[model samples]
Target: MLIILILPLLKANHPDFMNMATKAVKRAFLVALIPLLLFLSESTTGFIHKLPWFDIFLTSLDMSYKLDIFPTVFLPVALFVTWNILEYSLWYMAQDPNQQKFIKYLLIFLLTMIILVTSGNLITLFLGWEGVGIMSFLLISWYFSRNDAVVAAMQAVLYNRIGDIGFLMAFCWLISYSGSISLDFALATTAKSTTLPLVGFILAAASKSAQFGLHPWLASAMEGPTPVSALLHSSTMVVAGIYLLIRTQPLLGLNDTALTTCLCLGAISTAFAATAALTQNDIKKIVAYSTSSQLGLMMVAIGLNLPHLAMFHICTHAFFKAMLFMCSGIIIHSLNDEQDIRKMGGLQHHLPLTTTCVSIGSLALMGTPFLAGFYSKDAIIEAMNTSYVNFTALLLTLIAVSFTAVYSLRLMYFTSLKYPRHNVIINFDELSTPVFKTITRLCLGSIFAGWLILHFFLPSNDITHTMPPHIKMTALLITLLAFIIAFDLAKFHWTKEPKNKITSKQFSTNFYPIIIHRSVTTLTMNFSWNLTSHILDLLLLKALMPDLLKITQLPPMLMVRLSQSGLIKLYISALLITLFLAMIPTILL
Candidate 1:
């Protein structure tokens, strides 16, 4: 584990060496994981006990870590990181001059997430949390020359700072009430003391996962390189919040208010983002909104007291979501960075394999039958239906699930099935060996990884939902109905009618979240400027400093004026006065 953390720093200044270092780190993680998986495959419990050094490492640092869940979560995360790195090298950053630096950043980002997932103590978790946040800012604003990229990076950082406030509040509360930073200790706290921190954790998770009101940054984050998008959305930064809630499920399960809050937020976000995605033209933003939507479903699972299902979804979502982004990258890169789907068409003929992989990813995302998403997503929906919680949240989630299908199909229609829309007559094909292989591996995982992990890795008891056949089939039914709607919608031309344009515009602009965020930000900045520049600097500091200075210098000015007077008697008298004062002190002594 230490080697995985430290290996990325070796010879990082040299680009060539850094490339090799990343490859070596990937191998090191695989080597470390193989043994853990072997042990886990034998027995989930007591596997950590067998590894004496693991305990010693934790003891040396004087920090607690969740050993059992760590390996399970880390397996998928490690695989995703490895695949993302491979994609980063092959297609996304192939032409970039500073690809090596990007690779190093990605490795460090992976390490921080590792730190976060394994953390049993709040301090360690915070360290990892802040590390990922900083790395995200760097990676998102990679195209420093681009104004949008920089603004997007700033937006992400600022929104996450709000989440951090909640995180810190939870940390302080845990330490104050429990007298220990250990998550295990927090779990044992009374309901009265734990409720506030649980709320804090939910707030933090909402912001980090882009739930509802805190979701604009997720869409804006598309300005970054696609690989960064893949990594951030798939397994690292955004999922950090979901993982936090998953790790603290025991506490959350005890708090009714917190769980309800989560359910509401998740339901609203899933619906909002899915609706917005239906109108978006940017390929990456569509996928970004899909991510937010999926994250909301995960939150819904947590809210329904099904955190293991949330973890299950996270693991499955990572594979196809990463593949989707990478497939989008291939298209965007091929088209000279054109992200507007409206300008793209008939890509299935031009790039068959890439389009096929994208179709597979989209299908998996929509929770089509037997795909990776089907297992986890279907389970979540079923659980929501059977849940005795808010019926409104369940309704919103079901609507969002249908909307998920609509948008996914709409995306496929525009990018794959429609007639050619671009003026460029360039030949598009999946000829790159590395790109083909990378996506192919993910494609296979999209097909079978969910079943493999569900049967072998995940605890079966946690995911078992005994719902009626009709309720269980609701997700599939809604998805199919959405497909028919999408087919009918696709029959029309790309241009919108007069009445529809306004609604489309709203959805495409993320229903004014971006506008609202910008307006609020501008108002805050203007208010701050007025307070500082006009009130403090101009009125208070400028107005008072001169008077204060004059008051301080009055006695000195009088003394100087007296000494410089033209009258000899005044000077002589001043000199005599000085000598008299000096003699008086000596006499007193």
Candidate 2:
């Protein structure tokens, strides 16, 4: 772990060191990751060696420590994060001129991945947790030369920190309430009590996960690179929030109020993001909001006490959302970084593979039949039918269901569909455009992989056996309705509809709930940002360059004050006399 972490930093700062040192450092980071990979691979293959066909995957599970569940969340994420690190390192080392500018981002990226997946306790989680916040700040400032990038990156960090503070409080509360930060210990304790710390834990989980008010930051995060968006949406920033909820599921039984709040917030965030996404002109932003909204739905799934369904949705969402982000990246690259979907069209012929992958991703997003998203999205809403609380959740999910369709298709249409305009220029001048197609294949593989796992092997877990089929059927029906809505939207002529103009009031009408989330965000910006630095400056009261002149050449009032040294002698005499008097009194006593 130490070497794995160090190599990235060395590579990042390589230029400052000697020439040979740079090569050695770069090689060092790569070599370190290799050992971990070999060990894990050997262990897995050895354990599963005797099992037939597909049972081999299950055979490997026995090797893992029981404190940490294997193949479920941690191991997969760790392997993936390591892959991200190696990819980042290679990209950075290649010094592709264009990529060189963002090389320093490698360290932050890999560190975040390591800290998160290997986190054994809440504190460790926070370490990986906050690493993301810091890395986000750095990457956001990647194009620091741009005023937009700097401000946007700062906004991303500031907003996420507000959520991080909640995580910190929850971590502290966990230690106080449960006597340990271990996920098992805390869950065990939570399974026993109805207490305030449980409430704190819930708020922390909800806020960090982008529940309701904390949701806007995810949309703004599109200001960073598309790869960042893919990772962020898939397994890092956004996932951290949901992971906390899953990790703390044991304590959830202790407080119904906390769970209800999470449920309401999740519902509101989903509806809010979906509505907001519908009005977005920026393709990435539309997808960004959609990711947040989808995450909100997953939160609700967990809140409704359906974690297996939530986990299923999380897996499928990861597939489609990552594909969507990567595809959006391709479209943006093809159009010379033009993110406005309105400015994009006819890219289906230009980037056919990317277009195809995005279409599959979109189908998955809409929960169309036979797709990865279909099975999971259906299960969650269907599972909602089992109880009163769940029934309300089911209703909200259905009403909001079509919003996914509306925005998901709207996103694909503007970017890939043929919308004729008087003067439009589409540029495909970059290699990343084709490289993005490969990413799409990767995404499709993930989506298809899920279907294979579920259809053939049957997704095994603690709860799949007990779940009712009708509930799954109900979810499937809602998903089907959503797909129909997306298809209908796709058939419409959006370009011919008047001005091609989007309005603040109109967009806000759609985005109002999520945007209102911005007010607290605005107030927070003032405190952490505007008012905060102001307060810090007041505290520091440092001398500036201008003050150097003032000190050398005093103002008239200061000259007069300098001349008045008469009080200095008088003060010294008084001190001496007081000391003498005290000494005499002590001597006499």
Best-performing candidate as measured by TM-score: 1
List model 1 lDDT by residue over 1-589, tens digit each: 6575465577688657555655666676566666567655676552322122233322323444566654455555555555445555545677789877887787788878877887767767888889999999999999989999999999999989999999999888887777665677767774643588888888899889999888899999999988899889988899999989987877888788888998999999899889888778899999999999999999998898788888889888988998899889888877877899988989887888989999999999999999999999998988887768788898999999999998898888888986878755655557677687778888988999788767755553554446678887999999999988887878865435455555545435454775787799899999998878888777788778986788898989998876786998987898999999989978998
Find the number of clashing residue pairs for candidate 2: 3
lDDT of 1: 0.81
lDDT of 2 by residue, 1-589 (tens): 4354455455554554223332333454355445435544543321111111222432221111122332233334333433433343342234345454354454455556555645555656667777877887777666678787787777677667676676766777666677655556666765454656556555665555666665655666677777667767765667666766766777774567767877777887787777777778888888788787888888888777766566666656766676677677767655666778777777777777778877788778877777877777766665566556845655666766778877777777777788532135555532353354345445554567457435422223444446556665665566567666666766765655655455545646335434565676787787789776775565445345455567777777686776566888866887899899889978998
Quantify all predictions' global Cα lDDT against the true fold.
0.81, 0.62
Model 2: residue 181 alpha-carbon error in angstroms: 4.0
Local lDDT at 357 for model 1:
90
TM-score (all chains, Cα) for each model: 0.85, 0.72
Clashing pairs in 1: none
